[model samples]
Target: MQDEPRPDELIKAVADFLRDQIAPQISGHAAFKLRVGINALDLVTRQLALSADSDAEELASLKTLLGKDGTLVDLNSDLAERIASGVVDLSTPGVKDHLWRTTLAKLAVDQPNYASYRREMQGSESKEAASS
Candidate 1:
């Protein structure tokens, strides 16, 4: 009898199939579109599976920074307010900078690399036009 494939093996097989068979035929923007679609779906799945404990380290660090003077709720509110007002200077070396960078990195990962791809496409178009 054949054994069932593990989940990791199944995921890897699907990724391999996409890379070898599917992505190769896609052209230009289509390739980036497919890659972004897959990345978005993967991120959604990961976010759905996140646990309450996932932010434990960040929460601990926040608590240490805030100290015993205020409630966690108040501290969170104040932090958001300061950040929104641009009053919080993240350029300085501290926990605030760490938090800002972590949040920004997550946002950066979600952004599509379309600007660079668009420029490349435009360059190709201009070259083709000139040649013709």
Candidate 2:
């Protein structure tokens, strides 16, 4: 497989592309357009980190917010990459609606293969799942 593009390069390219090619063509004349432009750049930077590494520790740490099984539910790497590439509209007002909360709940009991440690968790109970 080929090496993935660095997230920083992707972010910079996105910013440059938007600034030089897209921003000029935007119809808005308001100062907020510039603010929106800056926000897009910042958002792109923030998104890039999501694909840098697996967020296992972050998921583990979020057990409280996520509930017992939520941490074990694996993140969709494709979703992470898309988010990093700005292909997913996470900045949209209703973006949270797309979260996989229900899947987490189901995984807490079924421990689907989509779980972070599916092979390890097989034939295990919730207590064993935690250690996995």
Candidate 3:
């Protein structure tokens, strides 16, 4: 909608300034708090950069798996209800893969550096490479 510096870019610039400039000038509790703030900004930037596509993918997957259409929230609730009622489970085709993809997408935004997430991503890449 706007010009060159998009929301994610602006957030990253602010985070970079905080990490590179302000952080070194602070100490103790304030420094820790500044680091937290920078981390939050970085997470927000990742969400802005990644969530749209991930959400769309998730919605499509949900629609296909559940064989119905609705807003994402409503579809997710429907799926949850079905799963709780034993109508859907891991044995259901696509459920396991859908869950894996959705979790990976969330982790990419929330905890890209998490050890388990890294391992899972590596595993996925290996599987893709092997398939190719």
Best by lDDT: 3
Candidate 1 residue pairs in clash (backbone atoms < 3 Å): none
In model 3, which regions exceed 4 Å deviation? none
Candidate 2 TM-score to native: 0.31
* Ranking of all candidate structures by their TM-score, best first: 3, 1, 2
Q: Candidate 1 lDDT, tens digit per residue, 1-132?
A: 447774445555665677678888998999999777666555554443342233554455566665534554576676678678877656534656557544543433343245754565577689999999
Relative to the true structure, candidate 3 reaches a TM of 0.94
Q: On residues 1-132, what C-alpha lDDT tens digit does candidate 3 reach at each position?
A: 799999999999999999999999999999999999999999999999999999999999999998989999999999999999999999999999999899999999999999999998999899999999
Kindly report which residue stretches of model 2 are placed more than 4 angstroms away from their true locations once superposed. Answer: 1-4, 16-31, 50-55, 64-67, 71-132
Cα lDDT, model 3, residue 81: 96
lDDT per residue for candidate 2 within 26-120, as digits (tens), equals 66565368657755665556545542232454454334332344434344444455577887664644334434443343343333345474643
Question: Model 1: runs farther than 4 Å from truth?
Answer: 1-13, 42-54, 68-77, 83-94, 100-132
On the 0 to 100 scale, the lDDT of residue 37 in model 1 is: 63
